[model samples]
Target: MKGIRGRYGQMKVLETELDSTVKLLDTTIFNKDNFYNALGRQQDFIIRPLLGPQKIRVNPVNNSLYIIESTNNKQHFTNSEDVYEHLLKHEFTKKNYVIQTVPANNQSVLHYHRFTLHRISSSSNWKVVHHSITGGNELGKIRHALPFLKFNKVVRNAANLLGNYYLACNTIVIEILQNKMGETWITDTILHERNSKWSQFHSLYSCKALRSYIPHTELCTKESLGKFLQSLRQVVLKPCVGQQGKGIVKVTKLDDNTFEIHENKQIININDFAKLYDYIHNHYLSKNDYIVQQFIVIGKIDDRLFDVRVMSQLDETEWIITGVLVKVATKGFFISNRASQLLTLEEALIWSNSKISFDKCVSLINEICGKASVVLEKNCKGITIIGFDIAIDSNGALWIIEGNYAPSTAMFYKFKYNEMYETIYKYINKNKKRFSPHSD
Candidate 1:
């Protein structure tokens, strides 16, 4: 009997009797002598590295079996028929696995994706084909090359904890599990904090390093707003659960007698405190759950506000900094969000023209973001990926502006960081079973 070991891009032979030890073979430069030496006086074996469209050689004189190594894990076979069956299992699983996004709207199919091979599906809950009873359909026969089959297993991902919602697969799920919050994590986090700004403040304030970075934030009540406006020259009022830079109003005191409010790149000079107070009362304090925060003077590139968006993922054992890019805001825009231009770390350094050396800045961003992720992960229950929005001030001090659990990994793909993007998906696919609550 012969044994096979499979890994992506490579395949090795294992001696079935001698403790199932693996014998590595150099596939590119085939060495018959090396293979003979590794498994001498035993059954000679053939190994094939089957990438897409690659040929696999068959030895007529010897016994051989196939091992299919998927990106997620390994599968083994004892014969060609079994190998075909295993391949069918993978294809069927890929076809069946579907992710229906939250809100279950007309766009639910848009978020459907298969975990086996990372691809968005045009349809969900694939049509079940009962090939065993009636000769399989043409598509089933062509795809699986089998006449009879049984696939009754239900593929379930995520949980009903948040009412059967499907959060996109990746590091975002880690944050939901860790924070015990679902798709509405932001709103949930605020609500869980007793609907107070201090709750969000206290969550991060527990970390010593993060404490210094957090601006002095207060609930936007009449008394607190007055105190903040008097004390800080530049203050920002943010809607508690808002995203994408929406509903953010920046107020900067010009003098004791005059101040300016900047929102959506439009500026209005308030002549007196009454106007400022009225603005706050009508636009923010009374209408929304707003937080008043001292605004940090973030570094800019070409006079456009910019910040570093660092993507990190928790792998099997440790955290990894997957990708880092600088997001430059649109001209005259204060927020560097999805609508902003993205720059590679090197490009960002060149554009900023800061005194700090490029290599040193990269190292600092990676270290700071990595450490910050660890702190957030430890504080939360099971956070996997942290998209840290880090800001560098005029003085070169690094401050983490925010940590987004469900950040878009599209930046990595857009910047041609496919390898890093794939690594994050590989981790997510490997641990997909744990995505459901209590699976750990």
Candidate 2:
């Protein structure tokens, strides 16, 4: 039977008894014929290329190089030539700065990704500890883990561990695949700014728990917006630190230079990208910073775009999915904050085009969010309950929209899921002692 993706989102065909081997897709042109074998079935951990900008930096302590950005970049360098020169300057004679044989596409695509691999135990090979039911690293089914180290001098020197993340555990084994098509593959590194929209995207982009859930996001710029609008039918512009969807604009490209921007209940048409960019800057970014994201056409039911918000709380040491709600965006708008209606997972998916059964959907949500909650706690401290905003694509694939640290529980109370509402308060009351033990 045909099943599972190999590379570039292609399904692999298994051969008959006579062949007893896997066949590749003709449509997916990979430089290596054995790309599947390379990516398939890792024993210790799964480390693959992140599809976006590539920025190289020297890890001076060990004299190694890293392709810095996990996905998108903020355009530090004006062009790719600058990035190449930067890479060449940081070259270490011992290791080649780049290696060819990229698995995704052969043409002008900068291949840059980093992942830490570790030896499981004395007897085990270095590999990922676990994957979700369907398996594979993507799909947010990945687990957060770092191979526990013994207290010793050998462990103290990080160079002893594998490459990739952080200084010392360098199992990344990055091989820069130069662009063959001659077009410069875009490359820019990350400069982390906390609490902003990009910070959330950065933390989860290659996170062991939520990498697959993050959408491609970058600082809004004339260059970045133009690129996003050309490739994506729609791109969302939002204040980097706004709440309740106050300054979010959904721009849909109608034709060459023509565009549509939706805000609140108003839709305005613009004829040029320059004009659109100028208008957004004047209206939304005059005082605050903004970010542009490749918009996912969140699955719609009854002509209303909607997404799922999973309420997660700590049940002792383990984070549990306490409740799930389908936030139905206000009609003629995509933001779910102004939800016209809220429905249980069953209520919404029953009417949804999602082919998966309700039970399976719940199962996936728990599996994906289970890992997400762990990462959330590590990144966001002093927090126990989280509202994970998840997008349900047309084909029923779930992608994380973002997490609400101070999520509102009123929806659960208003939607007649009082049990869920009470459950939330139950968690809050229970966890009160965890933070503050002083009692009346």
Candidate 3:
């Protein structure tokens, strides 16, 4: 996060309006226990925009709200029930999490931040765009950023965290920059397609070349659930827009009346279809939109299932797979990111017990990943890197699970893939995309 704090450049800080829909929760109740809170565009800090000056704490029990002041005593209670279980199930997830050893009295609260410049300048840190844009975070933004953007990449690169990144469209910035300043900027990130799982699936499904690799995914409704389970026999139900393996449920149709739902490595079998549907509706799909997809019998290594994480970057013309890691789910857990393990592609494939040849397996993974990236990029221009989660089935078939726009390299580093980690950022270090002016 140091890199983002030390940002440079003469700029102006901008305050975006808060949406009426987002709850500006009282975060005082958030102690070291409540580590999963997000800066939902309601508060700010001059010194550090995301140190969260006013943390709204919501009482999970009564849903009572308290602002930061009342939470000073640090008197907080962690949800002792399903919260831990839920977190444990996602233990094997991607780099969004961290494992640290510190005294209970003191723990570091760090987050992954991204600072964007003219075209595409991003790091785990922040940078100065023009003014306090990310200021009192002023110094931080310069330190991590301008140096990289200003200096030559052949010499060095740095990593820092200023704050977390959210998917807020730049319609406001675009309007003023164009009509007022006669300056224009292209979208340097994923637009509409990646937000909804169904939308992303449909876009890729529309492409004939990629259609085969996509699982039969449909919006999960009462009708769709019954139809999908009946037709696909076994399927996976997940939130329409989410990352990692959070809230993913695997369902298997054992017989006409019996059904199995695998979650958090535990299987709950229900005999009645209506009851099973109710259980799922109340638990996994609670008031949120979900998709039921035909479950591919993903291959297993010993008792655990594994998938591929391909970090693909854009070349001047096409996308290239820059980094590869295998995400092996915790044993018996259908959700791959829960308590997962990381392995090299070859290592996982070797232990995967698939009859497929290693060479052929690697080739298929690369092929599927490449094609998926092409399809995703075609939908949105200015996309430079894609972190693709690809799955391999029992028959050695490759499936495109999903792609992440802002991929993390912490996994590569934590797994001691130093060489690979450095290589991936080196491409990003340059921030190859430059400001191209579009004037009226």
Which of the predicted structures, 2 or 3, would earn the higher lDDT when compared with the native? 2
Clash count per candidate: 1, 15, 37
TM-score of 1: 0.53
Clashes (candidate 2): 15
Best candidate, lDDT-wise? 2
Worst 10 residues of 3 by lDDT: 170-179
| Per-residue alpha-carbon lDDT of candidate 3 for residues 58-169, written as tens digits (9 for 90 to 100) | 2233223222211122233344343334334422232122211111111121111222221112221222222112212445444534333332221111111112222221
Distance from true position, residue 7, model 3, in Å?
39
Off by over 4 Å in 1: 1-190, 193-198, 416-418, 436-440
Candidate 2, residue 324: lDDT = 87
Tens-digit lDDT track for model 2 on 97-204? 122122234333332222222331222233321111111233222321111221122122221222112221212111112233422211111222234565566446
Candidate 2, residue 51: lDDT: 24
1-440, model 1: which lDDT tens digit per residue?
A: 11111111112111112121111222322233443332332232333222111122222222354444433344555555554454445433321111111121222211111111111111223222111111234463354322112122111111111111222211110011011111111001011111123333544565676677667876555555667878888888887656677788898889987989999879999888877887766666544567688888877788887888878888765778877778888887777874467777677767787666778777877777776677555445466777778887777777767777667878767765567677767766666655766676
RMSD of 1: 24.7
TM for every model, in the order presented, reads 0.53, 0.57, 0.55
Model 3 TM-score, 2 decimals = 0.55
Residue 1 deviation, candidate 1, in Å?
Answer: 62
